[model samples]
Target chain A: MKILLSQSLMAYLSEPWPWYVSGGLIAIIMVLLLFSGKNFGVSATMRAGCSALGAGKINDFFHFDWKKAQGWNLLFIVGALIGGWIASTLLNDPEPLALGSRTAEHIKSLGLSLPKESKEIASGFLPAEFSKPEFVFSFKGILLMVLGGFFVGFGTRYAGGCTSGHAISGLSDLQPASLIAVIGFFIGGIAMTYFLLPLFYKQILFPLINELQNSFPK
Target chain B: MTKAEVISWYRIQEMFLFENFHMYGVIGTAVFLGLISVQLIKRFKAKDIDGNEIKFEPKVFSIPRYLFGGTIFGLGWAMTGACPGPMYTLVGHGYWSMLIVIAAALFGTFVYGIIRKKLPH
Candidate 1:
């Protein structure tokens, strides 16, 4: 019986599951959370952590009974981490990420390498550019990392939740705030992809990477 | 594996770029199930492990709050292509770059904690 279970598990993990199955599972997990009188969110863990680590001494926002209110939230995140471990280590497939052709071309044009049409199932989840120490230590990398991190952290706090918080829990509760937040998220996303991203790459990121100012498109 | 959950965000990115519809299907189905599950949980008056009644309070709203916050968050999302949950997944996948992102994010959170009193909730 155990052998049969492991075999099925491998089969399920080998390929992507259909959407409904994943969606239904997410709903079920949310239900379990709600039934236990808990709100589900990923960003809230920061608040809980800050409070636990004595940041309450500095700001009233961190001053709370986090162990009682947010202890479970922390546990949930740990579970997510463990689940991530299982996903990457055990269930991982050697398939190259199936990025869209246009997107693939755009990234390639940026001088980032990806799996070409020939072969070589991408060994890792991201392109090799992301894993390189030189990329991480680059000036462009520093700006993107710092600014990107700050924006995600501060914005989630300012918005009272992140994507999972608003899109899932807030929307499940039928809140106007979540609806507005979700809309704003899409708008921000659109702005970034269409305008800021290309411009940043051309003006600063790409130029800084190659040290070639003439690479800018006319 | 739940790595697909991590991939789903980029699927949204892909959708915005006019690539595909699978992410929409995933979100649609999840949200649909979410609505139903929330209603059922409320109707049944489900209890917790501690035997407390489960409830969802109505959330507060402000026009500018979500607009500004979400837009900022979206930019970061675009920058990283993954949010908090997936950040860990990236680490699990052995990408050292994500640690840099996560560290900066924690520092951001700490700064927020310091100034949170001044921010409008």
Candidate 2:
């Protein structure tokens, strides 16, 4: 069983053709968005939904009146769902990215409590605890997530756009603010990973890692 | 590059501010974008139909709002390991399941809209 799994995983990882295919598809989508006089931004799409539900028409950010413009964002969601599933299932690369040992240790220090099974100390990430449904719905988890969502929404509004608008659209358009926002994003991401996070986990993440390592195929 | 060209170049630099770096990129991007957006509202002089620009003037976002919002976004980002835009970029690359985040994001937006009138803006 182990051998079979490894072979399949290796095969998935070696599939280089998908990268090109996916890249091409994204370019096509970009062209379509450009032609429509609307930029593609997932964050903005949510704002659109908010407007639809009654956020008061303070701006036309959500007013993509064209019939085709209406549900195009939904297509983006569908596309992403399909993309992630394929990458994980077929590619067999489902594990979180290991940023580096030092980074990982820093994340651990943030009270994230790394899972013991995590191989290196600098793995730059706190293995996902909220990926599962149970964890996601938990009181503490859910509160953090919802509060997080509200923050993102409010932040995007104040920032005049979401990560995408700034990263892709704004960057492409040569917007200075977008440039700064992208920089701040990286800084903020690093600080959270290294500093503020430890205050919450309190060593819980490490034990989970230990449990995971023991269950490894080896 | 001309002055506008220089300015545009500068903007590009600012836009990509921390994308290549670690951690601070997310919040840096957010705040930078917000400030730029405020400037955009002013520079473009974009107005409402009455010939008066619909002021992009955000009265008072407050520090708490900024902190809370940054923390929330950072958490979601850390959990998913992909910010909102990249999530879509991932999809375009064929990560189909990212729709889950997209759906959740949309749902969150809907909920926010319903309660927007009551919230601090």
- Candidate 2 per-residue lDDT, tens place, B1-121, comes to 0111111111122222332232223333433454454456457765543455433222233444334444455444544455555555444433333445555665655555455455543
How accurate locally is residue A180 in candidate 2, as Cα lDDT from 0 to 100? 55
Local accuracy of candidate 1 as per-residue lDDT tens digits, B1-121: 2545444334545756767666666666678889987887788887787788877877777978887888878888877766777777667666668788777777677787777667665
Candidate 2 residues A1-87, lDDT tens each? 999999987775534333234333333454345444445566766665656655445444444542355467756656655654454
List model 1 lDDT by residue over A1-218, tens digit each.
99999999897776666777776777777777776777778888877777887888987888999999988888877777677667766776666556788877665655556644323322445556666778778776677777887788877777888867888778877889998888877787778877787788888776575666557664
- After superposition, the stretches of candidate 2 with alpha carbons farther than 4 Å from their true spots are A1-32, A35-37, A51-68, A94-98, A110-128, A202-218, B1-76, B85-121
Lowest-sum lDDT 10-residue window in model 1 chain A: A115-124
Question: Any runs in candidate 1 off by more than 4 Å, and if so which?
Answer: A1-8, A115-123, A207-218, B5-12, B117-121
Q: Residue A156: error of model 2 in Å? A: 2.2
lDDT of 2 at A85: 46
How would the docking of model 1 be graded?
A: medium
